[model samples]
Target: MARLKIADNLDGEPQTAEELAVKTHTNAPLLFRLLRALAGLGLVRADEEKRFHLTPLGRTMRTKGDGAFGDFMEMFLGDQFLPWTKYVDAIRTGKTQFDQLYGVPYYEHLKKNPDERGRFVNGLKQMTKIFNANITDYYDFTPFKHIVDIAGSDGTFLINILKNVPHARGTVFDEEPSIEAAKKNVLDYPNVKDRLDFVAGSFFTDPIPAGGDCYTMKSALDFEDELAIQILKNIRNKMKSGTKFLVIQTVVPDTDEFHIGKLFDQYLFMLTGGKERTKAEAEHVLRGTGFELNRIIPTTYPLWDILEATAV
Candidate 1:
């Protein structure tokens, strides 16, 4: 789908099969047959005149719409999809199928392939955009003089916070490539650029950027228990007493009831040795890593929550 930009091309207004194929450079007959199947599935609607436009469901497939889920579709349907082929191998051997499929860990594989990294990062961008849009509205940042976002890709979280709380200055900490991407994105907000700076280093290996009263990480702890605690400890080591730390993730619940985190945990099981955790499990990491759990703030966005903590 990303190859021919099939869904993307269709979003350029309704078109006949000939028109779509001509615009997208595909065989007209074959494209029409494919469109026919999609139409039956309610992804697209056909007019009596044979023009096709996106159904409400198909709008989610476009690359530019607010509802656009193409980034996720690109990632899951590409590199993330490969592991499912060896899923049984993962279950049988109790290992990450992604490592089996790519001969490297998931993160290392992305480091080797820039194209795949871009797609995966785009998927993250989508989720953070949603999280950032609603975050400041719910969580007060006014008390903080300086804020640090650990592993903040593209710096959207801090950018939104800096905008909302004008007295606040923010630092974005991430790896080299993500820091570079954040710098480019920062250019779009020259007015707020002074309040923002980027740091390039490993959150696990490097010292956490110092002097921010508020430290935040979003969706960064979807790791196995040991590594997750280690990551929190690394951050805790840098925090002065009373420094506030915010960890945002899809906080699962300890229940047999159905939840999206249960599904996300399964996806992680196949792709990495990581898994989503319940609120209790998340709080355990805080206590074990030398931080005091303040509260778990659930958001209007289901499954996502902020675990507020403080360095002891």
Candidate 2:
């Protein structure tokens, strides 16, 4: 991953191990060994000329491609590395390891460091591009006149949804930095820029913007029960009684199924005071927060599901 970033695949040139080591500021011999392993894995190949070229699999980690797996890789390994190393301890204790490792809450740490917050938010933005594509293609938004995305950075999801709805306007309720980033990176598209509004505040404290027929939370509800319910209750206070609510999340299955969400739940265990909830747990959480489960909308993706609900 570091090599992909160092090579900056946009350059479209094969690099010698020496050149790559220099570019990435690593020892040439060490870099060659790493590259050789990657070669063995077939993510890259070396020519007789001793120049390494990215393979199709390697290109998946380049930002130039249609895939956002690069950002996903960076976001996880870059930002969440330390806490993940302590996952074993977290699993044994059922406590947050992020706060323990960092000496502050993850969100609090973010608020104090704008650069990291920007990187993390942009990572999510990159991933959002693909998520929004699948959602707009498969879901129906024709009947909804307005949409609000909680903690939606750059309004990417809302912008895509509004593009489809045409007449719909949307709100992005997120951090101030995220609002700025969205303005610069996401809302420039002519279709939805004028129709989108950004409300800057922490969802843990603020009331969500009102008058939306739908509220979307994409990985935003991965908080402990009380805090998650507080956000829902806050949204409920501002929303009309019958407003639709959507949680696009890793809703864990109750079975001893060998699903990836189980791994994700474990990762969440390391980073948060939350775990991926089962359907019954989801229903319980939502019910306490002024919402009722309408349906669980399955998408083509296995790790994510759209849990539809109605504001009570």
Q: Which candidate leads in lDDT?
A: 1
Task: Report the poorest 10 consecutive residues by lDDT, candidate 1.
Answer: 1-10
Q: Estimate each model's TM-score.
A: 0.95, 0.93
Runs with alpha carbons beyond 4 Å of true place in candidate 1 = 1-3
TM-score for candidate 1: 0.95
Please, what are the lDDT tens digits per residue for candidate 1 over residues 1-312?
A: 445677788885899999999988999999999899989988888899999988888877766668777786777876888888887788898888888778898888889998899889987776566778879877999999999999998888788888888888999999999998889988888767998988899887898899999999976569887778778888988889999999888888787898898898889888778988877777787888888889988888765788889999
lDDT of each: 0.84, 0.79
Cα shift from native, residue 171, model 1 (Å): 0.5
